[model samples]
Target chain A: MTGPGRPAAVTGIGLAVSGLGTPDDLLQPDGAEEAFDPATGLTGRAMRHKDRASRFALRAAADALRDAGLLTGATFAGPASRTCVVVSTNFGNLDSVCTFADTIAEDSVLGLSPLGLPHTSSNSVAGWLAIEYGLRGPNLTVCNGGTGGLDALFWARAMIAADRADVALVVGVEPDTAPVARLVGHRPRLDGAAAVVLESVPHRRSRGAPPRAVITACTHGAALPDAVRAVRGTDRQPVGLWLTPAGPRPGDAASSWCATTRDLTARLGECSGALGVLQCVAGVSYLDASGPGAVLATSADGPDHTAVAALLLTAPGQAS
Target chain B: MSCVITGMGAVAAVGGGPEQIFTALCAGTSGLTKLRAFDLNRYRAHHAYEIDDRTGPGRDEPLRATRWLVDAVEQACADGGLTPAARVPVLLGTTLREQRSVELWWRGEGEVSAADLHFGPALRRRFGFTRTYTFANACAATLYALGLATDLLDLGMADAVVVAGTDAITESAFGTLDRVQNRTPEALRPFDRARAGMLMGEGASAVVVRRDGDGDRPALARIRGVSMNCDAYHPTAPDPAGIAAAMHAAHTRAGLGPDEIDLVMLHGSGTELNDAAEATALHAVFGDAAARPLMTAIKSMTGHTLGGSGLLSLIVAVLSLHRGVVPPIAGLTDPADEAAGLRLVSGTAATAPLRTAQVDAFGFGGINAVAVVERS
Candidate 1:
């Protein structure tokens, strides 16, 4: 197992749950909410150019960066040289892709939108973020299913620990469309997106950043043996906040810390790939107000099951 | 903690499984054929390395691409002597999802499944796998999967991780190639003077990576090092600096020098930009040296499988290292002016016992992945 690197600081966040608009919205998840708009500040040609998924991603990144005080006036003032960009997306801009393909099919090969083809790639959102912010370190785009969001978090932390980057911007995004909705089985009221900024403890201290949550430890295992051991060292807990696609899939290794495992399926309906990050956001907010929370994300409903567990520890003097 | 390739499987345009594909490569057989999967009458290019299903009545239960994935895994499991549990971790890469719905969904013929968009979860359910990863970095997809497999094995997350990649030629990709970019001419002839472009190929290839102590079977090769990095340059075109950085990182991680690379697997997509970009990156890494490790190109034989291309080349590399031969580049008249500086393997298979082999794949989205394997 790799050494748990210096605690990466989650200093900023941009949440886009369907019913709830922000992390504050997550705290009071009453079935009532306002219309979701990630394209608020981002306008003009860039907005016109990006598809829904990319727009959602850009909005989150911009908001998280703003929350982190990395913005200088209207631009990001953080050290772009070392800030890594990671975007976790499931389908990518499949709507534009389908439409692009439709044009080619209805017309010919030349019947293509040169502007649309690049955005059709699975990594387009990540690439656009990198280009938008000029982040040059490692522009990683992961495409795992429900765990992709947490996997991006795990990877971002590892990079920080390995001295791969000084700062990381990770966004978990999934846009809903007729095609994507049919694939994942449920459509959400709004496309989901969440962004969190992770800075090295050293970088955070240097910036005198006021961090919200400290990721004490984050890991994934093929077997549950290591996780049980890791949990034994944590505060005694119930299923504090369970984050499942529906009522937990059969093979999910429900954490010992969960109190009331929250069912996202019925509340927010089902989201495509943004579920993991949304869960992480909720976990962070829960830890901030409630107590220590564990996110148990499972993806073995088919047969061969794999579970990724992430622990959110309240900062020193957080709460009981 | 050494990572070894105990078993490998493939369903390529040239042949099925590694042994057959290796044999076909040695025979210099071309698999490029007329595009009959559907029909391409109006297009200027009417051929690709597409697999034609002439034997079986079109059965549509599980996806055809997913079937290839499972078959390749079965072959790898058999070779490794592994009865993988119900939850073996799987990592797959491909540019396009199983295209069952590409036409069907568009024309109101069939509905799209989770398999078409998010293939990992669908395959994970189909195979009953616990942990699964899908890397879609165009041509470099499987190499990315291979690198992640090494990480899972190194971290002891799983004793064995399935690293596979597959792509079925569809109107989405073929349409793009036929009209947008890298238009194919007959077949792929990469790094050659008479290069036309790359033909879209359909394939699914897998490698079983196990911790050194997982099995008693002899390892085919050892993964000494692997690196994945993106070119922050353009979306489609590759940045030489980005490609070189990835190659250098792979070398450093492998603890090998440029000279240690006994055999080099070129990304050679048979396109002008891809081939030129690859050559520039290689020149930066290896420089002008006559006695550099002998180089070989495989897409000419296997066709560019997009997401499956890198893994197909990797499967070929493992076979080459294990069998001690580099397959010839078919349909070659002369080397391109830019590639003239690089050593090309042609005419017949070269039998040079190689110690270290470095396989490279540069995908469309500017993702460059490199892996170095040594004869185990």
Candidate 2:
């Protein structure tokens, strides 16, 4: 097991999103088409075939890889370096699944799209990533409603700790479809995605890479606060924070605790699984400036529910 | 770091639990019978190993597959002398969540409810477990669950973990299979030149996992290692190269070479493609040793229980270790497929002390899992 104090460094990241298919596009939002939502906090170009979930995941994964400077071939140690990918989704292509149901209704035993059947699966994104990057180690797609993203991160940390993979890609994506919106009994909101590349602290130190934020601990389920207290003890120097859509807003006494994109999107009735990625991006964006010790919490309400809390501790001297 | 299998339970076409199923398997009694669980009027092949429909304490409810899974876990925990209230983590694997319920909902016979989606949570609640997870990786789900549980235990995540899987063939999924042309009406003939498609079966299996510790049971067996790999070749078809990632990883983790494997429990679903591909993969790993290891397929008796097949096969492997007997590969008569090379046990059971065994499970989405077990 990874020791309590020993950090798991975010060494490489990748993300892709709506209106911004690459990191360059996300970094310079003006370069792409204006993607904004007045009802919800989501802003992106609308595509018929590409739903909010896919758009969120694509962007988040691309940006995460870019943030860690892993997009280009020059960043990798070698072709053989083991990389694992874990993507989380709350609804898991709810749009496609609903569509499959509709198709079955229309043609009792006749026609069903071959492509749509596979696309509706929760692991479609993980399968896409594995095929896209040739990542052959430990690909997993986890669904725990709101905590999906945080759970993915936790699993990635475990994989790294177990020496299963050298670098891990953790992505979370959610969709804002009408069916999803209706199911959640909310209006559509902007869907989002986030990706984080994690590695052992020693490997990051050896690579001479700029000290990235270290994940000290993660807590899940209803007893998250207890787990968080157990991990953090009395230290409370968080400069910026992100909370789940339903999480209570942190008091003003703390530093900047901005509401996540999910909080905005959930209001607009979006059920996108990538909401956590957007929140993570926002959290990282804050920390990249003057923020430090940011905490992110993503919560989902469903039958198989979850709440994930992540603590990002900037390395000493690297705290912005 | 050897991971021990302290306890196991299973429900197959033959009967409920391991002993009953093994007895039926040894007797060469086929579990294939006319499908009476549901109305399959429009379907072609109707035979299935339908569990008795009894509920309330002793009855196998139509939804009893999941209930059976819980019972199996409870039985495994009891067999291992672990308290029911113990807070052991759980890892469950299945292809679909109560597929029968889904089919009923699809047919407009019932409402789409939380019970259909909350199978994992229901299991967690039934077992009173705090840390529980579910994996739906097609046929390789249970093996992956077992492998992950072992990994977690080795990493000191939990003292004891429960790995279980269940799947019940519902009419809708059966119809889908019929539409896809993947189901065979009559018998399952693995590695047979005249082999048709696979016959879908329904069943559940589970194993109690723990770190190698003090145990006096002479029948105990150890899980050395497990490996999973994705072909990325095709969503349904396996890589023709006979990708040996899973086999290699299992061998490496078990600290054993291919030559050391005494037996192989293949995922011989009786499908032409699956059997051939598995044969090729086995040959690639075992080389000249391929012809020596005793190879068998248990799917003929239990049917292809989708996600539960992996764990069910593992249970059979453990039983082999315990009983010192390897059952025959049921339907394969002639040596039609020489490419499978491995010694295909047939006719009757072979009594031999198996030092090490390998089990393989491959899913529809290019997911491949393999685990190595050794006599303790």
Candidate 3:
């Protein structure tokens, strides 16, 4: 819906993490507990079989929709068929799969629950979000390591750019269960979900909805800095802030071109797949409080950092 | 922008490569036999379409599906004559990713990590790819990835892209199916009046897609259009309306009418609801056309290959368009009442002059995807 130079707008943002309730909470470090219940905010039927990661996703999705003024009570008031859902997570369903396999191993085929079968699928989170909200547009799930969150956002932007949908709901979530902890060892794990609502400029304007920030570019490259450079291409417009997975260090190269750099992982436990969306959410909160400025969010795929992705966003009225 | 398929590779229960699998299908060879991947002493279902350990990556491998994935990608690159320096972006799709290895690890027999559950690092290490995406959209994942690959090419993101899917049978999936089926089916028989349920299979498939005239490589087929959507209705039940909408959208985007399609690779999982729902959707889309497309279900021989089934079907569709041969849905005798008006290939392979063909794939959680491929 945006022209070549025009940018898509982020109308709303939502987050659901242990001991944290909002995006602004990330700025102030608070001790997070090991367990957080997501059932308090979830309403409606057929949610009994939803896995932990899916529950976090549903809660975050609901909050995002409400923030966007597209949802009230338990019903969505927007154009359901014109909205799409994309989810990103690497080990969201590992616990469920392991439990199901245990049931089969111990009790044979008879012990398998019919309802439990669907939860083993990695896309169950996206599917449940769609079924709960009746979003019939394109549905996708990404599990491509650390850059997965950025990849999800890129696809959402791509869908809107190609006119496949007018609005896109992008979610990133991960579960820290017994099996996941055993597999990942002592690495920082994500225990909740983060979501962003992206809408075309025309669609946002037609609905008279205010934009928190506008996304100018999203891309994938071989490295995080290169990805940011690719998106910022040939432009001398200085970046106001850089939100990265790793914390900012002294004499950081990003400091030369960006006003400030904030470490997402330092504030919000290493989120892995949720890092990108959380970065965008943090960027939006910063721009909302700091006035017109540009923010660059970047993440890498694995320890090798061979694959990376970046997203560039600016305040509502700032030039891209 | 027009995206064309420059190369394809596949590894199914019946054979190891696209050409060998196609030839075996044409000869009515089925891979269904006693389930040997695991102990079946307490299970009701005794048979499945499984790849032989000797022919596959061996039974002791940590992750059999990853090996298959590597082989398929290597074959695809070789077929396309693409060097490792090309650095093609990869888009991978799967339902159960490395779950078999996880199952082994759970049983205290193998070692598996969080990294083993994904394919990005392995792919990059093997092919030096800098950009790769993994889509876990259930059985329809491959088609969903294919659609995104086309989008990447259309946007000029890369000169070439590799769309792939891989998965192995897991104890969880097999047990779930075994408990859900009313009666354990001895063999998968799609579209038959006596169809019972689906049998699980394992394998991997890949296709290299490039913009038309991107290189000197010969194009195997042109990907006209790909459409994906979610039913948002039920988790396991296939929605006829959603399937029909995807098919209609694919045809509309391809700039072709329903009559233009000469063949259709049906998502025939041999399940009662899936077959009936697919047929209903097909009838709704075609609507009394004089010459509707000839429908074929390779799962009759390959078994339901889960995640990789969609790309496997696309590869077969391309071969059919090139060779003018349509493999029959083996074991199907009498068509069901829901499939009465449709023309289904059965008993033996059919010969036809095909130009345009469509591949259908639907997954758990109501995901649906359809792709139209044609000989340009």
TM-score of chain A of each: 0.84, 0.74, 0.91
Models ranked on TM-score? 3, 1, 2
lDDT for every model? 0.70, 0.63, 0.84
Per-candidate TM-score against the hidden true structure: 0.88, 0.84, 0.95
Worst 10 residues of 1 chain B by lDDT: B53-62
Give the fraction of reference interface contacts each candidate recovers. 0.26, 0.06, 0.65
Lowest lDDT 10-mer window, candidate 3 chain B?
A: B53-62
Best by the DockQ measure: 3
lDDT of 3: 0.84
Q: Which candidate number maximizes lDDT?
A: 3
lDDT of 1 at B102: 48
* Candidate 1 segments whose C-alpha is farther than 4 A from its true place: A1-7, A16-20, A30-42, A69-84, A137-139, A158-167, A181-189, A199-208, A216-240, A249-267, A289-320, B54-62, B99-103, B120-127, B182-184
In terms of docking quality, model 3 is medium
**For model 2, what is the error of residue B34's alpha carbon versus the real structure, in angstroms, after optimal superposition?**
4.4
Candidate 3, A154-221: lDDT as tens digits: 88888777677889999999877877777767676778888999998889888988998888887876
